[model samples]
Target: MTSAHPTASRQRASAPHAKEHHMRKTVRTSIAAAAAAALLALTACGSSTDSSAPAADGPYTAPAKDITATISVSNWGDPGDKAVYDGVAKRFKEKYPNVTVNNNFTPITTWTEYVNKLVTQAAAGQAPDVINIATEGVELGMSNELFTPLDGFLKNDPEAASLRKDIDPKLLEGFSKDGSTYLMPNTFNTMVIYYNTKMFKAAGIERPSDDWTWDDFLAIAKKLTTGSGANKVYGFAMPYYSFGITPWLYSNGTSMMSADLQTAQLTDPKVKETLGWVRDLVTEHGVSPQPKGADPYQLFPAGKAAMTGAGHFVTGGFAKAGFSDYDILPWPKGTTKSTVFGAGAFAISKTSENPALSWEFIKMLTDQQTQKQWADAGAAVPSTKTAASTPEFLASPKHADEFYNSLSYAKPVAAPRAYNVLDPAFMRAMDEIMSGQDIGSSLEKAEKDVEEALQQ
Candidate 1:
């Protein structure tokens, strides 16, 4: 998986006072499980305070003369992200010569901390005019009233409509709430299996087809398992985080949360079955590493693991290491073939001093030219299909198209307003189950924890 997972910094920053203050009232009525309660509270709260104020709605008409105003944009900083932002900002400046694009991006190690920081800043009225939000924070941002609905702007701008047509509708749906649009879908990541071609040939196993089933996957893994310890080439590197593990849940037609995002599905028989199946890959089959401290990002590229699941973000690291012998494939099917994804969007904060300027800035950022820059960087699949299809985005890796193609059947990762709170619960259950705990009881306990959190 990508380093998108919470890191040591997240572990140290657990339970900030500010987070408690912001989410205090976010916990709604008990919903039998923490995941359900989190989703319920998040869905019911709407927007917070003055953050839900709508942006000025109309077709954005750029001023004939350049306007001298600054648009403050906030995003979780990543190394490659700043260059893209700077490039887009430079182009926007060509249109508004005097406008200053102040990007207030800070490095963030976890989505939980990023959301907390945004919520705290909004409370103090220091919120940026434009903010980058991901699927995990969409409900939280909405519940906190952090964004203005974008429907009015899109309705009035024909160009915006054209842009929307070029994006995957699933991404737009992921960024919307209550039948209204709140964000301009930007980029996204979908899970896929990365396999080492050299290992497959050495193991004398034929490359598996995209339609291979779970049984086929197990057989392949068994054949690929050949060594032990640091020299061990495990057949697969089991994913240790929620997003990394979700494709399995999805393929089996169950998830940690229900379709409506109002109930916990952790207790479902299918969910339990999926967890057990993965656990057995480590314990019973010994084809995958014990996931506790295994880092597939390192192990896969270093050739310690034969295959691992990750998204487009992995390509950058692989390139840096000059590891070019691998390729991607869709996750092996279980009951069905499916995948999970998470998307990011650029949203105008409701409290922006310059809503019109912010809207114009967003348009520039989502333009094909700007999206192409991001696509070339290879951090994510570009939101625009045009940019995504370009050779720069596809690069030279085999089966790279699988990343974008998965969008056809991908569901957004199950994130709600209380995701920060709920993720720990799910992870704890997974940690125990992967460590050889009974799957059924672990899920039952997770459901109980969910119920308890809601009651609080």
Candidate 2:
């Protein structure tokens, strides 16, 4: 939820492009939520034009005096990235003093547009030596043959092996194509139920009791929900975007898409019934607010509202803003206790001047020590079980238990062949549904739109 989601494709929406409507907070995918959306699936295409040129692997023995070349690392630079990337470049510099990394950080101001510019750069033979690719950029870069596979170097190294083992493999699943590996794992933020304890005090609702049900949640939500017009404070906002809402339907065992990815299973009456509660929270019960105007991240942290949907990445933002008095709990259960799981990794360029050097960088990026730095800083939830359970984090970290507990019910985002095209329209559909439109009707439209897009 803290990642950036890309905002554009080669084919821009005829309407003025929008980055967040019903969308959850992403600095905008991996690099922002758009990048994550694109990363949801994998691609095999390598760089074209000078594509046949063999990989320039290197021994990369550290020069007696480390030569300094600023590594042009690209990332979908969002607020989350700024928080997470802290000391990463510093750590890399500490490890290799001569290596200067100047980040070409992609602004999540509007991620889709940002991604298209990135792909154009990649396709035009101008991608930076190191880039932060997520679901969005991966498809564009891989299909157009921009990224060089990291498989060869990583498979043979020991430090790199340890780093890989230290991180979660779910990230690999998010960034793989066919049978090949493309990215190295980085930080991950999963979806969790963000609640306002102050609201609990107001409503006399006990802090989320273990083993609460969806019905139990709704009952409490109604009590805390209040206001009318712009003054409204929603008890909860069913993640208005598909990334937040889809899993709920899926966890309740309602398929969002058909097996062939051709039809909208949410078109079923039962499916509509399931989502109806989410809508009713706003329209029927007046317990929730309609999603609007960027994301409410600052609001929750600022204590403007009671409950909002969020995950680990937002923890720092909350603390910095002084809304540190919060607790994370399971997303209330329906038929089952399901929550969305997400992860990230790093990738070395195949055409790098020093593949070995790149491998070393990858190792440093994924190393447990480095991972611990990021996690302890409150940038994100670490991928390793060991990191998550560490005393330094658990004994002091806020929302510690809720963040780890959600993993038991975590489900990775569903990405088909190419994921970049899948997210925008899906967001649009979710927006429509949350606006009190028919869930069945909107999902059907989404299916048609997605099918047409994938074929393109």
Candidate 3:
């Protein structure tokens, strides 16, 4: 069932802010862990000159009504997400009375294992009609091999085509292989500072505003980490491999590769500075933790640490814990004002007998009205311009205002499946540097190691 276009597909949401550079960044990774990331980046960068036309060359339209079909979809557990999908499924059933849907859901706590389960189901020809997938999910599944291209349906259905607002170009890049669409975007998260107000007051640091920078962040982290026996708090979190460097890298205007995602070009001075800075956060500054598990939930929510790096997913957990008074501040400005956003999307398996029906259900989950409803309810950030701008999302919720403002300066790296590999490798290199090795030499070796892995 492979598409006529032998080339892989890619989806990206281009924003004005993605064009900006990253600020200070410092990270540590061992060579073994970052290899896959390097390969994924290289694969994504490969052949910017379209290998072929999009897979949507065929003109296919879904049936009008009364089809005896069903779609079983899976996603991370979010009441808001389920509700939106339920609404869409209901609408779909109304529109096509004959369609029956069998929905299979797994809690987010177990989402990391969903791909393995899916692969087994798929290999046994028992894959669902649709699936909710993120970066790890897609690459692990090599979703392009499994999911049918929606460009054909998108070209024919106005309802589907009207989704331009819902789908950001850079996000499309995240799901893309070359330059065509593979997965349909549902929602996205922009990385910003989520600060605890109580902690801020205790630390005697002023509330963060748009004017804050990395230096300001360090000051606040220092203050918040203060205390004596039985009450000592760590300042900032240690640099984690995932989602930690996005704002820093983008703000510093550096990338793991050249513009094309080809050839290891990460040895730039800015990248070195960023990595050194990250290491220093742990060693010299005594601000953040060592780049290990990098779990904010374990640190900040429990009040063992001051500031930590995380996304919208952290908000619900924080509120549930009764850690009142927090805000989403613009990621403290780096060398550049650019920001990094993480996201997820939905796609239908190509092997399914109900491609058209599956798309109808998937699109329904990500529509404008539904996205806003969910985001407002505190599930995930809406990807659309209109939905995100709403007052509910713009106000309160611990740096919510500043978090929203940072979107104007945001961009996301094309998170390909290889990140699952590259992230660990990148983190390992940092491990070596932290162990007291030469910074430039380690980076140069990492550059070689990362590029070599990509060549594989």
Candidate 4:
């Protein structure tokens, strides 16, 4: 469950802009310390490349209606997630009445912990037959030989083919490496700006347009900042993790790594400029809350902040907070309008004794009907085109479609094999720069750290 995007799985309790709660400091520290060891173990322990699995061939057909099997499906055990999976399980049962599907919900505090736990289960030979992996862990899972390739299944199954056609091709490609597909994408998330409509109206400011520029955003943010001390309302709150930061980097025409994910681009001039601009939002302009003291989720819903960044997962939280007077806007344009996105997919374990049953289960989970149910439940942005465009997903907040529109220019979160080691280092460097360290020196050090991690 390592997030396809950094921080994607960590739900902050009060954040209207996030779905999951925050990871404990202990978890972050443990992940940073154990990353290399975990990577080594992951590389050493599993068979990532299997040659004997059934190949996807001509049209795939399900086994006869009487076929019976039992398979365990593993996923993050969040209540919302469990509910979505429960619904999926219910529908899957209807299609295949005799199959015994065991839902194994593992409660985890962080993406790293989730990955570590899965690896442990895998090593202990207790891994679930079907596992949910995020984009962040897809490469790691593949490296460990943890999943069975779905290429054969996809090619041979008409249902899968139809489903694939509706899914974003980029998502499909993200789960595929060197011509093999490991995960069947279920849902995805994308970054967008969520602004409190009430705050904007109160400040006498216009709502942001889809094509709004960075300067436009800044001007509006400055106007929105008012109040004092405990009553002090900030204009914006920046997201502390890569999931939130990368959109700005991408929009500014820079990225943390090369497309191949093998080279660090932290020292690029555009990146340095982006970092400096972001820092100024806090230190110079005083428009955004400092990361250490701000609770944007609460602040935004309470009318203390004008804007924050998030994905679709935040909708439920915002509703629960009774903050209905808000809407989404596409991220303001820099060099271009861009955002970061990642997908979660169900992958069959290479070691599953019931591969056929597992495959069937995967198909059911990703089928159009289930995806539509996912959309209606507001669990995530559905992966299928038809489902994504359905009224169920597009109705809320009016601009929910921004998630889909942003996809045209969105980049997947970095998922290089070395990401486990590099992720913590990059986050530390970003934190340092944002806290007023010299940007050039901070990025230079981060560049060196990433290079060293790659070597390790």
Which candidate gets the maximum TM-score versus the true structure?
A: 4
Full-model lDDT for every candidate = 0.69, 0.56, 0.56, 0.72
lDDT of 3 by residue, 1-456 (tens): 000000000111111111110100111111111222222332333223222212466655666786676667755444445666677777777888888887765433233344345544545546566766554435434432545666666676778766864555666776666555777766666666666667777767777767678888887777666665666678776525435565677777786656545555557888788777777777887776665544545566567676765555445545555665666567777776776665567776655666777777877777876777756665356666667677877665734654445556776543333443455555567677777676778778767765766566
lDDT of 2 by residue, 1-456 (tens): 333121110011100222332232433332343453332222222232232112335432333336665455656444545655655777778767887776656554566666565555555554455656544344444544445676655565444566667555655665666666777756666666778776777678777765678888887777776776767776775545555665567557665555434444546665677777677776788776666563446455545566766556555555555555667777777888776655555665544454445555666666677667656766466666667778876753355766656656665555443344456566677688777687877877877776775576
TM-score: model 2 vs. ground truth: 0.76
- lDDT winner among the candidates? 4
TM-score of each: 0.85, 0.76, 0.74, 0.88
Winner on TM-score between 1 and 4 is 4
Instruction: Record all residue pairs in model 1 with backbone atoms less than 3 Å apart, i.e. clashing.
Output: 33-450, 33-451, 34-450, 47-145, 48-144, 48-145
Question: In candidate 2, which residue ranges exceed 4 Å CA deviation?
Answer: 1-72, 78-102, 110-124, 135-155, 177-180, 226-233, 258-271, 293-295, 298-305, 350-353, 385-387, 390-392, 395-399, 417-420
Candidate 1 Cα misplacement greater than 4 A, ranges = 1-60, 63-65, 110-120, 454-456
- Lowest summed lDDT over 10 consecutive residues: which window, candidate 2? 6-15
Per-residue alpha-carbon lDDT of candidate 1 for residues 310-413, written as tens digits (9 for 90 to 100): 76766765676677889888888988899888766788876676777888889987899888876877567788899888887677586788878988877887
Residue 30 miss distance in model 2 (angstroms): 12
Q: Candidate 1 local accuracy as lDDT?
A: 0.69
